[model samples]
Target: MSTTFEEITRPDNGPLVELNNNMQEVFSQYRKMREYASYLEYELKQKDEHILKVENENSFLRDKHTTFDSNGKSVEPIIT
Candidate 1:
């Protein structure tokens, strides 16, 4: 639901109109902050997914090019 400025300032509410406007301003700010928070949450989720994908790819490549010697040390494969 939305309210126009004229409607919000209507004469019917009399003494309470001033208070009503203040409350409305506070609510408007709250709504904006909530929207920003939601956007940040979405971006964070996307970044986390990307990081996980990159980590997995790196692990796969590393294993493919690496070998374990009998001494329990990592031996990188040579591509002559």
Candidate 2:
């Protein structure tokens, strides 16, 4: 009986089974790390947007609180 190249290269009967196994494990770990990094980037972007939104709202509120509506003048002393 003669062995074909496909049969010899098949995963189940490969000569470098151990190397293949290690490579698969390393690839899996790399994928996991990439997914984790993607999630972290999304989280950071969301946090940054949230912070900017909150800061803008805060600035609006502070301006409204300090400015008098009667004459459109600020009641608080301007700090130089």
Candidate 3:
């Protein structure tokens, strides 16, 4: 009379519910980290592209500014 039907026969499912909730929280945090990592990857690629463009421009300017001697040696650059 004192024991309920659920308490006597049904196994306790509270722990299972708690475990499932914890798994959901972990997956949510994992997704956020993955998104942040992808954003950082995009930023890094943009930075690399900017660096390549700058280097190419610098090379072009250097070739335009410098003078070569007849002995295949570089002379002092005369920057206008």
Candidate 4:
């Protein structure tokens, strides 16, 4: 005799089938979340590197344009 899907997944086996389906869904969702987390981590790292680069450029520009007075004192730029 050949066994059909309906016969194998009858009411008697309904709970086991449901449990397997639920587990598969949970695992699928977990994998997706892990992938998203990895992408977010990569984006954060890139942003941090860009921020550092900008800060270093700003520091270099500030040092390059710094002015000193005859009294050996640093002079602040007038914002007027």
Task: State which candidate has the highest lDDT.
Answer: 3
Overlapping backbone residue pairs in candidate 1 total 0
Worst 10 residues of 3 by lDDT: 1-10
Q: On residues 1-80, what C-alpha lDDT tens digit does candidate 1 reach at each position?
A: 99666545536775598899999999999999999999999999999999999999999998888899999899877789
CA lDDT, every prediction? 0.91, 0.87, 0.94, 0.91
Worst 10 residues of 4 by lDDT: 3-12
Model 4: per-residue Cα lDDT at residue 11: 64
Compare candidates 2 and 4 on TM-score and give the better one: 4
Off by over 4 Å in 1: 1-15
Q: Tell me which residue pairs clash in candidate 3.
A: none
Q: Model 3: C-alpha RMSD to truth?
A: 4.8
Question: Judged by lDDT against the true structure, how good is candidate 3?
Answer: 0.94
lDDT of 2 by residue, 1-80 (tens): 99666545535756588889999999999999999999999999999999999999999989866856578766885789
lDDT of 3 by residue, 2-79 (tens): 965554577899999999999999999999999999999999999999999999999999888888999978799766
Indicate which candidate wins on TM-score.
Answer: 3
**Per-residue alpha-carbon lDDT of model 4 for 1-80, expressed as tens digits?**
99666545436887998999999999999999999999999999999999999999999998777888999777888778
- Provide TM-scores for the models: 0.74, 0.67, 0.79, 0.71
Off by over 4 Å in 4: 1-11, 69-73, 77-80
